[model samples]
Target: MNSCPFQRARSPEQKAERRAQILEAAALFFAEQRFAAISLAAIARQSGVTKAALYRYFPSKEALFLALYLSELDAMVEAPLPQEGPAWAAISELLIARPLFCRLTSILHTVLEHNLDESQAREFKQALLACFAQLAARLQRDFALEGDQAIRFLMQVQQSVIGCWAVSQPAPVVASVIKAPPLDVFQVEFGDALRTQLRALQAAL
Candidate 1:
């Protein structure tokens, strides 16, 4: 018997649940559409929450998407980096298997992070640094590298993924043009480029 215009005020647990529900809906949208093209209103519509209620949890669409990105980053930190087989293939396989995560990586720094406020940005970056530390530790365990060296390698691989995703993901016309055998030299498959870069890094190390 509680009634409010936007929605009844939520308990802390309910708030967290609502936040997660919004994130799940937003993830599906991001998977289907480009990150820059999606709006907060669309996300709220998909999540079945009013815009005001959604704002209560996320503050902004960028913040919400950043949360999704960070969640995926945490999962990556937990998952072991490729130990056996071609390192490039392993890296590409891992990224391709989680296409949404891979897609968001290309926009996280430039678009999503750029729109956030200082406080929110700091909070997210702090969590990211922790994830990076976890990744470095994991890499050191599996590869013959020092802590700093492991972090350097991981950072390079991260940069390669972002760059490759950007160059390889194109519009329909561009993609069609790139498919021609003569233009193959200009064509770029993100996973393949990522894999090649990763393999080179592995070879060096």
Candidate 2:
């Protein structure tokens, strides 16, 4: 096996590049295959680094996975929210354009299904909640929703998004699982139902 690229100290630029490569490889691997089936050795090989080098950057597979997960969260927060439209438009744009939102949900589901340790699981939950809270705050501020109603609405939206993404059915079966009377009878509709629900909330408010 090749050594980890991070095993030796290098210039800041080189180190940054190597870490980015490892993260890129990890993300691709996670997306392409089951997280439980992937091994650190495979990641190291995919990254063109030895196990030791991979370890130097990420001490274990879990650490690497968590790092990737956190990176995804950071990306979501840093991504541009729609600036030129009403709050609802901005929220819709964010839901549709932010790859990290979906990716993070997918990762969280994988971690939960695979039975990660308590600490890891808790961290993932906290990160997910934090993302939701950030979205809720933004909505409240930009849309002028206030008080308990805003909080309740945010919670509902958060749950709706999580339910939409975290469910494991094939695309065709998602509608049955959701079973909302007004939702269209289609599976895996991406942002459609969420947008509709949010629009309803806006209309009510």
Candidate 3:
């Protein structure tokens, strides 16, 4: 006699739990290996799912990466600004304290340098500009910065930070150094730089 076996379909909660597990595993794998080099099979193996099952959750590696990218962005934007500081110091602290900060920067650099298609690259650029725009809006509301000048100042600060990250050798070392400088040091130097340039623009306005 032959016996018949039945498998139960997972509930929505169970499916979501499995997807989270896969994402967590993928995040670890991506952190350990280069994003461009890692295969979906490797992610599946690490995630303890078959490739087909992984596909059901994430159609492609790019999709999975995009999900991860957005997650990192959410974390960065949601992090609390420092309660008391000059504007630049507060901004630096917010950037540095995010759990995904270094990885987020690394991923952005990686995407810009390779892997992204033209459309995807355009979308990424838009998202970056949008983030800066939001930051500028927040600054204007909180600190009373004026008009387009405020937005341009925010953009300059963002560009300066990205430029530093891009050319810096030994990425981790540079990330650490930027975070460790004294409050006064950053406020007097970087803050003055932003304020002077922005105030000049504000004066013209």
- The lDDT for every candidate, in the order shown, is 0.77, 0.66, 0.60
Alpha carbon lDDT at 77, candidate 3: 62
Writing each residue's lDDT as its tens digit, candidate 3 over 28-81 gives 876676667788887777666677877887766876776666666666666666
lDDT of 2 by residue, 1-205 (tens): 2244435548998788778878888887877776778888888787777778888887667667777867766766566666565655666667667545455555555453254577766876687667656766665666666655666775665555666665433444664656675554544565776677677766666
Candidates ranked, most accurate by TM-score first: 1, 2, 3
Look at candidate 2 and tell me the lDDT of residue 185: 51
Model 3 ranges off by over 4 Å: 1-12, 107-134, 147-158, 171-205
lDDT of 1 at 22: 83
- Steric collisions counted per model: 0, 5, 0
After best superposition, candidate 3 residue 190: deviation in angstroms? 14
True-structure RMSD, every candidate = 3.5, 5.6, 8.3
Q: Model 2 lDDT vs. the true structure?
A: 0.66
Q: Considering lDDT, where higher is better, how would the candidates rank from best to worst?
A: 1, 2, 3
lDDT of 1 by residue, 4-48 (tens): 334534688877767777888898888788777888887887777
Relative to the true structure, candidate 2 has a C-alpha RMSD (angstroms) of 5.6
Please list the residue runs of candidate 1 whose C-alpha ends up more than 4 Å from where it truly belongs after superposition: 1-9, 80-90
Task: Give the deviation of candidate 3 from the true structure as CA RMSD.
Answer: 8.3
Clash list (residue pairs), candidate 2: 2-50, 3-50, 4-50, 4-53, 4-54
